[model samples]
Target: MIETDAAGKIMFARRALFAVLFLVTMVGSLCLAALALSPGGFGIFDVVVLGLFAITLPWMVAGFCNALIGFVIMRFSADPVAAVLPAVELVRDDDPVTASTAILLCVRNELPERTIRNLAPMLEGLCASGYAERFHLYLLSDTGDAELAIGEEAFFSELIATWGDRIAISYRRRTVNSGFKAGNIRDFCERWGNRHEFAITLDADSFMPADAIIRLVQIMQVDPKLGILQGLIVGLPSTSLFARIFQFGMRLGMRSYTIGSAWWQGDCGPYWGHNAILRLKPFTEHCQLPLLARDGEIERHILSHDQIEAALMRAAGYHVRVLPREDLGWEDNPPTLLEFMRRDLRWCQGNMQYWRLVTLPNLTLVSRYQLVLAILMFIGSPAWVGLLGLATAALALCDDPADVMRSDIGSVLLLWILVMWFSPKIAGALDVLLAREERRAFGGAGRFIVNFAIETGYSIILCPILWISHTIFLFGRLFHRDINWMVQIRDDHAVPFELALRDLWPQTLVGCLSLGLVMYSQPWALPYILLLAGGPACAAPFATVTAWALLGGLAARTGIGRLPEETAAPEHLLDLALPAIKSASRPPLTSSV
Candidate 1:
């Protein structure tokens, strides 16, 4: 690993270069666009447009630069050094496990049967690894529903009876879930953390190979200063077309992006809550979350706790880092667009809550920047919307619509924005294309290209819908509206028309308003306006459960949007753990209450 001071210096230099490039590009582009839009003079409308541009340019620039750096790093670096832990060979079958570790499976009102189905294989694998005595597994439930709790108990009882003697297995359900998942974990730390050196937290949907789990423990044992080691998690075993498309892109993009991020973050990397191993002593002592005061409400719980925990760990002088290993961990994605939006809404609120803690005492500058970026991720959508509105108003009020359309600089700016927006996906595709092994794993060049094109098209159609959903969600969160902590919908089911309409009317209204305004102001720009509005206008229908099923089936028959795991899984444990892919048509047995 690079020395801490040397790494910090390099990261600072890279960040400075990125900032300079971003400012130059954004200023140059905006100035050209402004000249094209109004060569006569600057006006109030132009000033508003420029202000919106200033607010939104950083997000665009950051994304492009990140992708560029990631592409270069992944293309050139064969084996990047891990930032947090020293490299070690995998433990042999006869190697005696010295440290005690706990696997904490945290669940809420999720399907107990499904959870058991996923867990049974991992437990079997652990026993097979010949280190069963060294590791214990805990079923940490926060279910409040009486019937669901009983079902969870029944499942836990059966699982314990099946494998209790093979490994230490325990179950606990909270009567009152005070702070959600974070609180559940804190409770576990208070009760059992002292007994173990490390705890590997897992979500209900998380799956990791037993060997990978062992490797994490080994790495942590080697590095006493390591507080958290996060593994790269990719979406897997998706059945729906929407999920397949979304996850395929995620799998492609995350590998390189994570490596680049880890390089820059160095010792102060992010913790994504799960699919990570944490040193119990430091975590328990340093990462206890305190409530934030907001609008007369004292003791307001943090919605997103993982980043804060990582920050706290760093504040206590422990290194937190992410391992960018794509082959290790797996997770599930929302099966439908509406469900995805629902999940995103919760994340939007959680990330926005970081604004409350960005200036918390004892945070490193990098940690504070991480918090600020988290807030900007959601906030950028609204800023983009404002920019669009200002640009549209300027166009509508312009004395010469013909001149605005004739301007080559305006067209160039539009093209540049599109390129920057999709650069990450392009970079990911290039990474795959350049690597023979990666391309082969994606089912050869032809199939890979087909999948890439389909995913890109799907993402474009879905982007506007997300933009509107996130903007509204951000506004609601700012107003201190409470989000009901509910179980995530994980199965494929058709959304009710009424539900879709109720959820998506704001998007539809925005689409209609945008189209109407554009048609009134510049009929020549109708195509751009329609493109902007189409996704939102059709979001309700597109979000129908029936629509997702049909699209998924069509993609399946066409042999497009196939994930590498679906084509050929690298981990034997995955096949053993999940013997059969669950059918999308199977209804979820539990409610997300």
Candidate 2:
């Protein structure tokens, strides 16, 4: 176990300060509002509402404070922290270094052609940088389908024929997908991990610059104790309106938030599964995940393994760091709202599983806190729905309806909710506007403002729909329902109208019932009621793939959510990679070579 050093002490002190401040702000604001709402006296309903508020209020405040700290750091700091490799100069054609690193591309039953296309650029970039000899590339496949396996082999053969002479490229397909991606990596470690000092884990859609990859290796070489180092991954290039808007907001907010979190977290940071480097020996020794059993029944193995791995490494006396770099890495986003939720469904289940592991023996306090925060991330949605239900119940039981509506407490609570919910977006917008260079990258002040306005409006409408859907997913897990391990829908395709309605009708129903109830007793809450009802009413159309595509296209044409990558493509990397993949010689479908 790692001892808390001077830096660690400072980090802990700052974290303690933030924690106390957050608790005080959250509890004071909520308690004051509770007292004001029930001026006459405390009733059973008031007590219940307050208790529910106490449970949910910290989640909201924690997010707000994180964003608030991020905004202050980005706005005030002379030189804000960013994720950049140390002193990476342009490599000479003859420059070569010797370091053994394995680049593992773990794939399930995904489109093999697309995966090759994505991999081609990084391969070409490495060759061009003269680092081709330093790294070995492995296409580790856990494909279960017989036909897909054949296709994958055909592509792999072609790739090997072209690049085998220059780079140590190989392919292996496992008949059984045993432990999923984590298991796939563990298998590799057992077989060949000892040969390499470090391994860079990548997802199917992950793309990193050659320089960035080399930089990661160099950093690991310097810090022998670093177990995992995660780079910031921005959304990949997208023309679709939904993706552009979603990515644009993410780009704006992710940097500042990450930097601020890193400052407080210090050594004990997050490890996103992909676009990160792991030290092989330490990972092999400390990161084997345990299977959890409950009440004589063995539950499915852990779905989200990255964070647990990081925690395990830290518990074994290693540091896990997240490098906040904008240009280093890229990954794809779900192109439509329905696809987004489908992905969220899996993630919600995985994050919720952490509840079982938080109390695991010998884990650090910060590590445990991280697990709790992750659990709260999904659980907060249901808790939010619970809070609204309690408030509605209190309203129903109130003897004087006029007092409930007219009290200054109602206004304060509404204002508090709105401010806390949207403050991160506000801070992100400020970060964009404050820096002239960043502002110009997003197409100047006017375009930036327009994009923020549109994104905020869209998010407000989508909030309740997501809330209801997440609540359903969480409750489903409570009943021990099985989640299918399905390939993500990466391409933009139209969702059928009937299918959209079938999936989202429950959300629509909840919206209608909640709005109807509020309107009957408290017509003054029409504004909030409308916000709750809007998402469900719009769910069918938004859920339709074609509808969002059209909206995304319109938004793109109007310059609402413009990102720099869209305007300025990474020509050096993509130009070399895309052409090579398209023109590469391919073997016949039936060829066994």
84-136 per-residue lDDT for model 2 (tens digits): 22212333323445569999999988887778777777888889877798899
Identify the runs in model 1 with alpha carbons over 4 angstroms from their true place: 1-38, 81-96, 294-299, 402-406, 545-547, 571-593
Model 1, 1-593: lDDT tens digits are: 56967856877886677567667877886776676557656677567766766666666666677677777777776555443223434334345667999999999999987777667767878899888999999999999989889989998999999999899999999987877789999999999999999999999988887877887888787778889999989886665767878888887777656766666667788899999999999999999998766457445677789999999999999999887777668888888887788788888888887887888899998899789888777777887777656657766787876544446776787788777777777788898888787776666688788778877767766888888888787777667687767888877677777888998998878877777888887878777766567677777777784346676665544445666664465555345433123232123222211
User: What local lDDT score does residue 551 receive in model 1, on the 0 to 100 scale?
Assistant: 62
Candidate 1 to native Cα RMSD, angstroms: 5.2
- What's the CA RMSD for each of the models? 5.2, 6.8
Clashes of each: 2, 2
TM-scores for candidates 1 onward, in order: 0.91, 0.90
